[model samples]
Target: MRSKIYNAPCERESVRLLRFAAATAALSALAVLAPATASALPAEKKPSPSVVDVHDSELTDKQIRDFWTPERVKEALRNPAKAPATRAARSRTATSPSPSPDLAASAPARGFAADAARSGANTAAGLSVSQEVPAGAGNNIVGKLIYVSPTGELTHCSAASIVSANKNTIWTAGHCVHEGDGSGEAGWSKYVMYYPGYSRGADPVGEWTAARLHAPTAWTQDGDAYEADIAAVVLNPRLDGNLEDVVGYAFGYLFTENRTDYAGAAVMGYPAEGYQRSDLDGERLMYCAGDTTDAFPLNPFDDRIKLDCDMGRGVSGGAFVWGPQNDPRIVGAASHVALDDAGQRVSDDLFSSEHGSYAAALINTVNNEG
Candidate 1:
């Protein structure tokens, strides 16, 4: 059945304030929005993801960590990185696209939280709109991903820790890690670091460096296919422990889920621009909650999920989640914010490729190999 798309109102102050306060103390402390049932479906076989070793050269993990001094991070924040863009369309009434026939009947949806719990879990144009997540108000799992782009530009994007066997996995957009298609070794980023629970210049859980980066071959070889824009990083263990352990929790994964399943979901990130609030500068976590639809006329065949969010640059790779508020599961990562003919972002639209076999395989490859 097709799900109806509904515009979520600007988050209410009372609700926003409560989440802000709780997110600051501990996101896990929040209650689950609903209970989830374990899926009885069998896992599907899919190809592994392409992996890149960030420490393959003389660059040791410590050096990579030291590379990002407070001064450098602040500088990177000043230049919020732009996500790869797509030609914008004017219609908002397009119908949802169908999942690929081969993947349509694949495994039932499944999720795994920080402690290994299961759970179930859009868009517009014009500078892209987003609500600022209060500084230090506590969703530490979601934070800024800072890296030196292939072009030597220090930039940032939103990323989150996810439940994994090594306890060191974080999810983000493929473009955040690689240059796309034929750009190759020169395209891979350097000195990738994640700051969970980051507030205005505060590193509540400290910094973690990436050991390896993984992206679907579809993304590395085929350019910016929305479905393949997802990417994962295997992080080196911090002095304290795994990332999730140090951060207190990690979001669960929701794979092979249908777009209609996300009737209500929350997308969180550190958006750098497009909002009127001066306080938002890509250092604070921001969020938008609403119903999602298919990418429709934008790319009718890919079946990307759509929402009415105006979050701009630096928000790419942000987490799109649904389920219990305390134990939310990630369904997809932010990929593209549609751009109009004049090269401006559509005011209220965002898109994420639907997570299916490819997504499951990407995460599995990183967990087992990276």
Candidate 2:
């Protein structure tokens, strides 16, 4: 798994890879171990008025595409934890220095994207069996996300396409776009590279690049804020056309708090464990379908959904879908892994931040600007 802190001066250790048993997997892995509820936000409130908007990368579309070659992507998958992009969690009271007047004065207004209509009826109630996406697949909107961190190390995660007026908005865990390091030390990710329907080291519809990032202040300020872990990325269209025109599918999502208990969903990602267990080198997409439960005590809040899926590392930013994996709407995006009683990172029972005002605002920001 990626280290919880990014760019820290620490040696990395090898984490064992774990995969879900196709027939034996069940929803019994849900466990809420931690109980620090002090920072939990009320679920009914709107997103915070202030958000962190970042578009500071210097790499252009061509530069990013050229930098992240197939060889680099393979190397990153081989050593998944070598250089995690996660930011270390600091005390909640830690504060960041203010931006210069030029930056603060020119910041855009806080925005919101109307929750798109939910698509496809909720169906099935079982664990999501791990499946590999095929090459040349049509209507596939979910795929691998690759990028270079500020330290210049190649990093990656999973992301899903979302329906938007711009038709270029994508969603994933906040840490996927920005290092989750506590305030001041963190910033937007650089050299953003995305490959939708990437299977077996192949870019099915070619790669896309990120133009901007919209994330909740909670995550930007506190790396441990799992409830606020989701982020929305606006992409620069490909040379051929817009993202939707190429993939031909983008999902809608729900922002209300009512979708938590729904069991008809699938959490999909390009799990590194799958690569370790086989010869694919983490290039295949895997998912675990099941109902979402409260990750409360362990997560210390209601903002995250707990599932029994056993995905690892590279899957951090994968989507939690409400219907079919290909053309489904989303309710959450996977963020962090839970720790066992022994304080060891556990692969099963992953948590995802639920879609809310923070997500809506991210979508809006991208639509208005991207």
lDDT agreement with native, every candidate: 0.59, 0.54
Once fitted onto the true fold, the runs of candidate 2 whose alpha carbons sit more than 4 angstroms away are: 1-49, 81-125, 133-139, 183-186, 274-280, 297-300, 324-327, 341-343
Model 2 residue 28 distance off true place after TM-score fit, in angstroms: 26
Clashing pairs for model 2 are 5-86, 5-88, 6-86, 34-297, 34-298, 87-181, 128-288, 128-289
| Superposed model 1: Cα runs more than 4 Å off | 1-58, 84-129, 134-138, 257-261, 275-279, 297-300
Worst 10 residues of 2 by lDDT: 104-113
Prediction 2 TM-score vs. true = 0.71
* lDDT of model number 2: 0.54
The lDDT, on a scale of 0 to 1, for candidate 1 is 0.59
Residue 152, model 1: Cα distance from true site in angstroms:
0.7
lDDT of 1 by residue, 216-283 (tens): 65555554344566788888897789886666556776666334235556678877765334455677
lDDT of 2 by residue, 210-283 (tens): 87777766567665443456778788877788886677556556554323544556677777753123433466
